[model samples]
Target chain A: RAEAKLIDGKAIAADVREEVRVGVAQMKEKIGKVPGLAVVLVGERKDSQTYVNAKKKACAEAGIDSFGTDLPGDATEEEVLKVVADYNADPNVHGILVQLPMPDHIDEERVLGAISYEKDVDGFHPLNTGRLAQRGREPLFVPCTPRGCIELLERSGIEIAGKEAVVVGRSNVVGIPAAMLLQRRDATVTIVHSRTPNSEEIVRRADIVIAACGRMEMVKGSWLKPGAAVIDVGINAKDDPSKKLGYRLVGDADFESCKEVAGAITPVPGGVGPMTIAILLKNTMEGAMRAYGMM
Target chain B: RAEAKLIDGKAIAADVREEVRVGVAQMKEKIGKVPGLAVVLVGERKDSQTYVNAKKKACAEAGIDSFGTDLPGDATEEEVLKVVADYNADPNVHGILVQLPMPDHIDEERVLGAISYEKDVDGFHPLNTGRLAQRGREPLFVPCTPRGCIELLERSGIEIAGKEAVVVGRSNVVGIPAAMLLQRRDATVTIVHSRTPNSEEIVRRADIVIAACGRMEMVKGSWLKPGAAVIDVGINAKDDPSKKLGYRLVGDADFESCKEVAGAITPVPGGVGPMTIAILLKNTMEGAMRAYGMM
Candidate 1:
């Protein structure tokens, strides 16, 4: 069998960002202000800072106005909610995201719930989650990662309806929503996670396998169905002395072996990594459109 | 191998109903009104009538007041909503259930949503559904069948946490919520449904398998893990010439064969059948408790 073709998520993400840029431009011309995203980052986690920076950069690149608020580790939950409330009242800030893993003293749910559903760009609100899960109801914004995964597949012209799709994670963030989205497209979707014994056997029968569990190299080439499409959502840092950071980004699937048997596969670092920011930009643009009744 | 034990759901349900009777008696004394359920049956479908009668009988035996509204085949959507509004306002009625598969003319969602979340005994309301799915949020009522499945296992002394659970259906009512309930209990849950190509292989690895796809005998004995616990949620009507009705209720599993392999298994008609009403009664009591601030 020929080696599987690589699914270039980075390239597709760039195209998506370009489309979002145009959409934002159009919305700004009609609505008097560019779409704005307010990102609230608490504490000083390096990874969180990196993600926040990337998001702000993407907004600027898309010509969408962006705002950031950083609070020290000692900041109270009330202070964070204050920032959220401020954005909720600001018509200019169409999207709001609170960086994850808030300080230990904070009531995460209450703070997350404080954001208006219209401004919940992360799509973590129970209302949006419900809309996505239920039939016939449409979520105002699909979560970025799941939306990005589906966008990549749609751009590839892969048929989703009635296909055997396997999602190898069950995280509230990715796996559950991903399965729901796939089912919406009419694919038979199964979710397998750490507790799933014989997961390899299950994955082998799928025409589409999505690896989102953060276990590096858990899914091997032998687990792939011949010509199956693989979407790797894991971004684990593996020790690599050769790198300046002394670490390398690896996906849930072993790229070396899986690419040989899979019809198409995504690479870590360059795969799902790029699409997240692009979808965030898309969501921001859509938020602007919806705020103006353009959807 | 030792012959697996058969979990007699008929006996289990009887016990559950008896327990609910005591609870209802206590509530009636304290609240001055017996917990009441309003069952809205749409159309003249015989199977629906049978199910409604079963629910009513169970409610009666448990000392819960029951009322039925059987609309004709030609009832308008507004007609259903009117009854829902009536129940919503009725102080005595603690639970309201609209039988599933309403006629094609009626907008099902609008009808279901018409019932107030407080009176949504069937737990189909989007608010309740969202509550159930959200991590920290708990619904006032859980859908009956899934709750029944869990109640049966727990009453049988089957441990769920840290077990490998495989759910063989992904329906909104049964499979999905069941998986969520199990996951909340710390079970490693995998949902395998129509999209799962090698479901048998996946099922064989599960410490517990829940069959809810409503397909008769779809799960073979070979699909069961050695000494696994099995709960069959399917209620398929199969031809039975010996029966007066010319049909019999069979579960999603091949019971005889599965009993040989499974450590514990619930029978088709007796397994999950009785527990659904039991849980419904339980939910009504809880709803009343909440409404009265006694919980």
Candidate 2:
């Protein structure tokens, strides 16, 4: 049986962070300025807090300035909007990210829409998203997760242009934008969602498969074409009695089985997870350079 | 030979126009206001003039107000922007359309972007385009041609959801947006462009096919899946000495051959062409309703 080459997203993401660190240092040297990112957290979800902490730590390590606004879970939508507006007007803040899954009272779309597109590091702003979708138009920023997925593919030397690529989700965050990016790179891209009747057959024909449907082990070895490159963006938790936490993280692809068929594949924990913050730092640095008229 | 049922876009477009005309009349009777569409033409291209004239005629027949701004071929970019800005501010103008392919000197994007998204009946604004692409998000308006394609499909009782839809082109105006619209309707969508090496195989797998590649007879009858619904959006001129004009219009699909295999197909000149202006008028009426707080 042929074993698949591991697409080490952790290592690639580290390299990207190092590049951003260097870029940040050089920008500081050239203009006495460092990129600033403002993270707005509106709730107290444990998962959200952990993700926010990781992002803040990553920013510090990259020599980027980090700004935070912590609002009570019950805060008013106006309060969230005020904070976002302040960041939009702040000269030091090159990027603004409103943490997702905000309190129920907060209208996520309205808050995200309020962010200045130039500082919309998360790329949730529709203007950035629209530009990204259009041919010959350049977006100020792309959402981090999908950008990370593309980085993983390109760094692993996977060819995209003229290839058959299928994205197994239609999420605005990952699947949709990832398909857009792949199509922009000249790949014939298909998006199969929950409603798709022949998704497995479609997956079997792809040279590249992006599994972001958030289903546990949805993509199996039998679903892939031999030698296909698989980038699994799904990170679902499966219960495991043997594990200390009583659970194990698994990607949408059934790793144990898919490895035998895929030419290369990314593991769940060590894959797309680390790449998000790394790309955020990169987007922040780029935003700073644009703000300073240096790039 | 079993000939495919003609989709009859001409009749369907006429129905849409009639709907818009009634809506406009109702609004006028109820609120003493009719929808207004502003056509901004920057160059003296004959084709553009003809299109502008047709739009104006359509507006008059529908009892909608039409406004025009004509500039020379050498019009400055600033001059065009100013015209768009004026229309954006005019309360009477519910929709603004900048005739495309402006002179080489003008920045088309800047002019298009200047139109307020609220009045962007043409749906070329990046905001509208982006909203159309994002899941769970709605655009103020959809582009005319792509919207017309979907209308043709639905009006013909063709089921879209859960179907395999292959859009053969990646143009921002037609192909990209059409794919977005199809996916929105729950179809598993694939977009194949010039760079797609296996375009025919992909097309052969589709339950529905949208041919907007602008290549004359590029999609052969052999390339289609039997019973696939085909909507041809391409209009190309083929030299025909038999025609009075020395040329005849054709679509990307070879109509004579495709009719044998397709379940239903739209003809070249009588097809998607009439649908564009019809959709534009419909969009203008909707924009007016939105402005007047009617819808």
Candidate 3:
């Protein structure tokens, strides 16, 4: 048995935040302005609220300006769109992000699409997503989680070019975009989901695996091609009364067992989670930089 | 060995073309004007000219007006973009497609992006492509070959939902779009490309397979999972001095051997090729119908 390397997402995210902090300072000094991000939160789902709060806090730490608006749970899509329109028109706001899982009454796509594409920092905009998948075309913003995964891989000193990579899920936000990113990097990529009859067999042959299917512990240790690098993007809450909250967060992979066979692995909570926030801030800063033609 | 059923793409395409013809006629009778498709050909390549002619002829058969112009091979990108802008403004034009493989002097994306998203019949525009990958959003047009692949499967009564489908390639035009389409149909899909280590092994487990890698005879019969349905989209020119043309067309799959083991398969010359033009006409008609609020 051999020891596996832990891909410390928190440490890598710290590196990114530091870079953004310095970059933000330089932009402010040279251009007399700092990057600014605006988030519109509709409905107060506890989880979504917590995520939004973290984003605002990250903006502060990275020397970027943050502005946000909170709408009631019963807010109409029109109301949300109105708030987004204001942010979209604000020249000071370099990036506009409407928090996801808005109340069911809201048409999420219409609201998201209404945000001017230039200010779509979340990278959920269709044009950006499609451009990211294209060869030779640059997307304005790469979705945060997928961007975070690539950051982890590159910062870990692992070679991505010409490697065999498998993405377990095909969600537009993560899995699909992640596969596109991998392909752009010259990795031969594959995607598998619930319908896949031989997911385990397909995964066991990967040089690198990205698990974003949101199924808790679905990928078992036995599925790992020994020494495969695994990046788990799933965040599922499993009931564990041992903690005061009566639940604990787990990823798509069976962490403890899979780590034994994986050459490198990221932990559930501290891995992909922090990297996402870091990338969001990075996108916001980059968007500002591009707007100023400084980069 | 028992003989395998041939997936007669030509027949399936004929069915689609007929449907479009009826749909177009109804539109003309009800609205007093037929849908129109405009093809902008910038070069004099014999193959590109032939393809353009085929598309115009299909448009005529389907009762859709065909518009085009043959520009010199040395046409500037600005010149091509100006032409696209004119078509974009013309109310009569419903679908605008720029013939691909434009002279090296012209930038494809610049010209394609110039077309109004509403009139982008090629579906190569970033917004349409991005929308296709999106879950709830329906794209105005899907890239023809990928759309044709789905049509072939649906017309033949092969179920896609909850099936294992493997797409061999990840090109933006065919491979990537095909994978997304299959996913939308509830097929668990995997994509394998040049960098894939075990493309054959991964593909062999599929209930359906789409080979769009453009490599001649890359898929072998030895790689088939018995009874798998195969769609061959590759169009490669292999040297064959036996003919006046000096080369013959072949697909990514080694058809003879694969068909022997597969439950059903499409032939190289007659399969996906005919379906592409058929889908293009279908898209043009549908786009016009949507514009008139008829569909």
Candidate 4:
């Protein structure tokens, strides 16, 4: 059995970051200012904080200004909305990202909708999401995770057009967008979810499989077509006494066995994780360029 | 082979029209005004003119006021846009429908985008189109043709959720929206386009197949899963010396052969055609109710 070649999302993310850094530098020199991203956090979730810190750190390394607001866990939705409105009016803020898992009392949709579409680099805006589903009308920004998945496939020299791609989820942020993106690239796409019967039978015939259902290793070895390229986007915490945290992140794909037959596979934590932050930086830079009328 | 049940779209459309008529009278009594749909036709293309007339007649039968504008064949893009703006502001106009395939001279997208989404009966605007693809959020209007296809299945009492739906096209107008609508109803969906390889292989697995690829009789009997319910949205003109105009209408599905293996199916010309007009009337009435704060 052939061990599938691992797609090194880390190295690719590094390359993307380097390119964005260069672009940011040139934009700063030409426009007299650096690109800035403002990430608004409402709740005090530890994971959300960790993600925000990583985003701000990447922005700093890439020559982008990082601005953030840490609101109290019980902050009113109005308070959080006020912060978004402030950023929307700020000339220095090129992009606005409201970290998800907002306070339970807050209306997340209302807050995300309030961000100016021009500054909606997070690409969660309904209008931006709509643009991605549309052809010919360019979206302001593609959602980072799905964008990262496409980047992985392209950067790894995989052919997307005319391929049979199976997406095992129908989520707005990941699965739906990935299916739409693949279809845009001319791939014949299918979306199978919990409602789907014979999901395994359908998945077994795919040329490319994206497991993003968020279930832990629900897709097994037999679901793959021999030599098919697999991209696993799920990150679930599984108990692992061998790990320092007592739990380790595992992807939706059973990576150990899937890799045995897959032509190419991406590993759990390092695969899609780094690419997401990298693309966020890239989107911020693009947003800044569009804002400056620099293409 | 067992013959399939023919879905009676004409009779169903008549029923829908009657229901809309009753709704229109009740709204008139309550609000002192009926729903009004303004159809803006950019040029004098015969087919476009024919469609506009059909729509106006349908509106009249349903007790909805129908206003129309007929610009010259060579009207400038700005001229068409000005009319659209006028209708958008008119208090009486609850729905604004710009007849499609506007003279090649006009920018169709620009014109469609200018229509207020609230009055966008055609549902071609980027925002409305995006809303259709999304989950949780609702689109202001579903494109009539796609909406009609789902109506056919529902009226026929076919189950959508947990079924295998194959939509054979990706046109934003019909195919893509239809796929999204079925998926929203909990059916697993696969979309196949001209770029797809082995489309027949994929279509063969459908529990419900929607043929909208605009190819005459492209799908044959061999592609059907046993007892599949099929909705044909394609209307192609085929060369036929027997007809006065020397051409006849055909759907994407090979009806004679496909019906033999399917449990139910819709015919060309009378099937999706009447339903589109019926749905348009329904949408306009609903739009008026929403605008009038009656809903």
Candidate 5:
């Protein structure tokens, strides 16, 4: 059997970022303004800080302004909500994103709901999510990771309409939204989550498979249909004495084995990870355009 | 093969209506108040009028107060929105239902969006729909027909968890919400729509099938898996000289053939149709209870 072609999410994401960069420049030339993203971090979690820094760096590289608000872990829900309200009213901020997994003291839904749906770049607001799920309606912004997954397929010239697609997992962030997006594209989409039985048998029948259950290498090559297109969204740390970091990142699907049978696949580290921030930039730009009546 | 047991939606709906009647009576005795539903009608469409009358009659039977607003066909968009705003502020009105397909001049989305999500018993508001689609979030109200379909399944003691359920069609009111509802119940759900190339083959793999495509007798016995439970939401009119009205109502499934192959199924006129109004009353009652702190 021929080896599967790599989906090259890194390159596709770079292309997306470049497009946003150009769009940002055009907006600057036309309106004398640049799109701005306001990111609110509630706690001092190391992982959240790292993600915030990466997003700010990406904004700088793309010629978009970035605003940051760091709150204490013990911040009151009202305090956090005030920050969101401030950002919501700031004309300079085209997008507002609240970093997730805040301290147990805060209500995430209340905080996310506080962000204006117009500037909800993370697309975590129920209004944006509902619009995305409904037919004849369009969300102002799609959740970044799921949008990136669809971008990978469309950029790779993979057909979605009328195809059988299976999404493994039902997380609100990635799996559920990804399934909804695929269904919107006219694919016969099925979602198999942790509670699902016979998931492997269901997956083997798909023309396109999205593995996002957060389990490391759970989808083996034997579980895939021959010539299926696979996109692995999971990034789990696996112990590897051979690496300097003492652990290596792997996806939900075993790439080495899956690449031999699948017609196309995306690898872990450089795949969906890069695309998320790129799509965030795109969403920010779009938000700015819509605000300025330039869309 | 044994014939499939009929899912008696009329009897179940009667039970639900009785429950609502008792609840309404209790509320009246406890607080000297009854649930009130405001029905808004614009234009003179015969079908819309018929539906509105049926809804009011149902409310009366359930011991709930009914409110009505009738407007000319040429009513302005602002007029419709003003009516919704009035109902939103009315403490007596717990649920506001705007009859659909208003004159082409009025924007339906704008009118629907104007209703407070709390009083949106129709569940057509994007926020409610979005909440329904999201995991761990709850909608104040779910759309009537789709909710009815689930009520039938639950009342019939069908296990939804860990099952392979297929939803046919993707309409905003029925198909999309129904699919989301099924997925919420932990069913591995597949949605096959008009654009799907092999819908029949896909439907054949389901343990539970919800046919809502509005196509008459489109799903044949051959298209179903043996013993698969079927809920036919489609109610199409077919000419029949033998019938008193010179026409007869049939579902999306071929009843004779499907009954022989299926484990359980809902009939056309006596099935999902009755449950829709029943659920509406239930939702209205729940909304009133929430307002009174009874729930």
Candidate 6:
């Protein structure tokens, strides 16, 4: 088999961000206001903050207005709900997202579900979920992570139709919708999760493997088809004694061996990671357009 | 390997119907109205009418009120939408199902989307689909065939959690949601469709194989994991010269050979067939209860 090309997710995501920047600028001029996204963070979890900062930075580069509400770790559920409720009714706030895994005391479901479906930029709203599952209807916002994965593939010129695609996870946020989106694109998809006894062997036969299992090194090179494209969605924190921070991020798949066998592959840190923020910005702009009936 | 047990879907569905019958009677007395399902047939297609008749018959035996609207073949999209709108507004109608493969003239997407998500008893509503896809939030109604497949397995005392389940086919109405439902029950799930080249080999490793490919005898006994439970959801009309209807219905798997290798297997016509309508009634009752806040 011929060697596979390395898929540059970072470059693709950068291009997407540039496109979003243009779209937002056009919409702002036509509509007399820029698309606005409001993100609420309940606590100062370092990772969540980094994600939020990246999202805000992306929004800025895309010419979309971004707002953030950071509450103390001890904030009550009602405190977060109040912020969400305020955004839900704001005409200027076209999209709203409450960063996940809030403090233990806050009821995450109540707060997340509180966001109106139309402004659910995070795509966690049941309404958006419904939209993804319904055959012909388009989701107001496909969840960013899954959407990013597909965007990476499409932007990379991978043909999904009639391909054997295996997704190694069943996460509602990523795996489930990723499978749905891939299947919608005509890929014959197989979703193998924790319950799968011989997941490695199963994945080895796929033409395309999407490893979003979140377990570091769960998918190795031997588990992939010789020329298969690999998209690793996991961003796991692994202990690295040599690092100044004492840890580093690694994907679910072992990249070293996988790159040797995979025909095309998305590297961790620089791969699917960047595309997620890009898609979030895109979804926000799309949400604004959809709300204005331009969709 | 030891001989497999053949699961009798006919008897299982019959048992389910009886349970629904009891529930329907109780619901009627408690709510002052029997659960009602309105099936809209947009044309004179014979196959559709047969399905409509079957559903109506099941509703009657279960003591649920049923209504049908059979429009002409040339009916406009608005005309069909009118029926759906009427059913949506009718307090008496607890569930609404528009027969599939509507005539060419009607815009099926617009018409299907027109049905109020609340009365979408077939669970085709995007909202319901989304609800079903979410982790903890259950749908108001799960689509019949998928729900039926799971119910059949559960009632027969089969263990779903921690089992390896392979679903053949990935249709929106059946394969996709069936896998999701199985995952909800803690089954490790994999979906294989037409594009799956090594489907038979994959099937042989599964503890539970759900065949919904709609192809007669495509899966053979060799594909079975010895002692695995098989759920055949395919209802294909094949050339059976001996049958009076000019053909006989068979499942995706070769039942005769499958029964020899499978621990339990449901036959084509008798297996998942009866369970489909049974689950429809169950969904309607559940929908009624949800709407009435009884659940």
| lDDT for each candidate structure | 0.86, 0.94, 0.89, 0.91, 0.94, 0.85
- List residue ranges in candidate 4 displaced over 4 A: A74-78, B73-78
Per-residue lDDT tens digits for candidate 4, residues B87-156, read 9899999999998888787777788889999998878887788778877778889999999999999999
Error of 5 at B284 (Å): 0.4
Q: Write the per-residue lDDT of candidate 5 for residues B1-295, one digit (tens) a residue.
A: 7899899999999999999999999999999999999999999999999999999999999999999999999999999999999999999999999999889999887888889999899999888988999889999999999999999999999989989999998999899899989999999999989999998899999989999998999999889999999999999999999999999999988888999899999999899999999999999999999999999
Maximum-DockQ candidate: 2
Full-model lDDT, candidate 3: 0.89
After TM-score superposition, the amount by which residue B283's alpha carbon in candidate 4 deviates from its true location, in angstroms, is: 0.4
Ranking by TM-score: 5, 2, 4, 3, 6, 1
Candidate 4 TM-score to native: 0.97
Error of 2 at B40 (Å): 0.5
Clashing pairs in 6: A4-A263, A130-B130, B5-B263, B7-B265
Angstrom error of the Cα, residue B210, model 1: value is 3.6
- iRMS, model 2 (angstroms): 0.6
Off by over 4 Å in 2: none
Candidate 3's C-alpha runs over 4 A off are: A73-79, B74-78
- The DockQ of each candidate is 0.31, 0.93, 0.59, 0.75, 0.89, 0.48
User: Candidate 4 residues A1-295, lDDT tens each?
Assistant: 7799899989999999999999999988887888999999887899999999999999999999999999999999889989999999998999999999887788877888899989998788877877788766778898999999999999999999999999999888899999999999999999999989888998998988999999999888888999999999999999999999999999999998899989999999889878999999999999999889998
Candidate 5 Cα misplacement greater than 4 A, ranges:
none
Backbone clash numbers for all candidates listed: 1, 0, 0, 0, 1, 4
Residue A160 Cα positional deviation in candidate 2, in Å, after optimal superposition: 0.6
- lDDT (Cα, tens digit) per residue for candidate 3, span B1-295: 7756898999999999999999998888898989999999987899899999999999999989999978899888888888999999988999999998888877777787788989888899888988988767888889999999999989888999988899998888898899889988988777787877778888887899999888889999889998899999999999999989999999999998998888889998999999999999998988898888888
Report the C-alpha displacement of residue B203, candidate 5, in angstroms. Answer: 0.6
Cα lDDT for residue A114, candidate 4: 91
TM-score to native of every candidate shown: 0.83, 0.99, 0.93, 0.97, 0.99, 0.86
How well does candidate 3 reproduce the true complex, by DockQ? Answer: 0.59
Shift of residue B185 alpha carbon in model 6, Å: 2.3
